[model samples]
Target: MTGALTVRVLSGLTELSLTPPLARAIWGEDDGPEDPVLLQVLQRVGGLVAGALDPQGQVWAYLVGLPTARADTQHSHRLGVHPDVRRQGLGEQLKRFQQTWCLERDVTRVTWTFDPLLLANAHLNIHRLGAVAVAYLPNYYGAMAGINAGVPSDRFEVVWPLGGAHTHAPWPMGPAVDPLRDDLPADLPGALALCVPRDYYRLLREDPALALEWRQRSAPLFSRLFQAGHTLVDVDLSRGQYLFRRTAC
Candidate 1:
């Protein structure tokens, strides 16, 4: 996948023309289209807008981001990879490109939010890219559609600190445990582990009430832990656990 694809920065009208279709392809027809005018403004003002193109000149993935209130930080607003070409490392390639694009402009950190129940995203962000979640937003976007339609828009706000020591550490490992039934530890270890359902989307389709119940159960726990100064450092995919560590102030 990497050999055949090229990742490049998009500008002006190009960002506008390409992003909406790519977003729809990834998130389905109900996915809200990002405002092209906003994207153009962001592109002109040194924000990062990039895409992955296949050999045939078709965009298979794209990332949209903008400078945050902090001069040295960027907020990655959206990242989408076309359904047909997913699981091919295109998402990671786009992220690496985004990182390089930001670092070139002296930006030191990039932040984004992701649904905590999506284990694949958890593995990619927390485990692969070395991002840490510092806050949890319950029903963050109110009610969203497409992949996020049924469930509440609960999210984990993660920060990826460029040039940090944590980025270089190897991915962590943990014993496999069923997230649905495993007993959560009462005392916080130097690092603690918590779980999300293995297939939350399916759970939503088959049992919507149970899905909401999971959200009700998790929101308070995540909020309390994050407020207590614990940061989510990694995700163990085999066991479906999101690992959090006590960070020294």
Candidate 2:
């Protein structure tokens, strides 16, 4: 069982200092923390930098957001939960806190990006947060380190609508895309199931070649689906598939 958590809107150097160490703990050495100067600036300019503290007073999770060109929206840049406290709902709690924070400030939408192959992230971002993947970005960041090392940085840009009722369309029964196959479907379907590895990190560790192959194969497929007016609305975590439905352009 998890202990009580206090989610607070963090400010000042002291509270914010807790984030850097926590980030390194969660993301490894190469993926370090957000710059302190940037964090302070975000707080000063209507952005959010918040943390979740466990009962022992340790900051276990942190989230950061920045104002966007559209005043009604914000881009959530980073969210990290310490490895020790993961899978205990702390991530969801921090997001819910972000939702409340955004709603109060008249921000109605939150946007972020994540790797399309990560099952846990896909489940949380699509299934748990009610976000829609509007675009497919291939090699978005060019290169990276730590867990993401040696892999192309493809991402799904998603937006989570806040301050109102939101829902993803029901999962569709449609054609499936075989991840292992080299071939691509000739045409788009009304609904599509794009399967991914159940555990991408394992594949990356054991067989980096196969992992890179998956990225190369699915990159074009995702781009084509989005081009054909399909939006990623849901994910089947158990089956490790993303559910995309074609919509009118």
lDDT of each: 0.80, 0.85
Residue 177, candidate 1: how far off, in angstroms?
8.7
lDDT of 1: 0.80
lDDT tens digits, residue span 160-228, model 2:
998666576776665567767845468767788888888887898899999999888888888998888
TM-score for predicted model 1 compared with the true structure = 0.88
Cα deviation at 138, candidate 1, in Å, is: 0.9
| TM-score against native, each model | 0.88, 0.93
Q: Model 1 — which ten-residue stretch has the worst lDDT? A: 168-177
lDDT of 1 by residue, 65-150 (tens): 88888999999989988878878898888888888888898998999999888888888888888888889998999988776777
Off by over 4 Å in 2: 1-3
Instruction: Spell out the clash pairs found in candidate 2.
Output: none
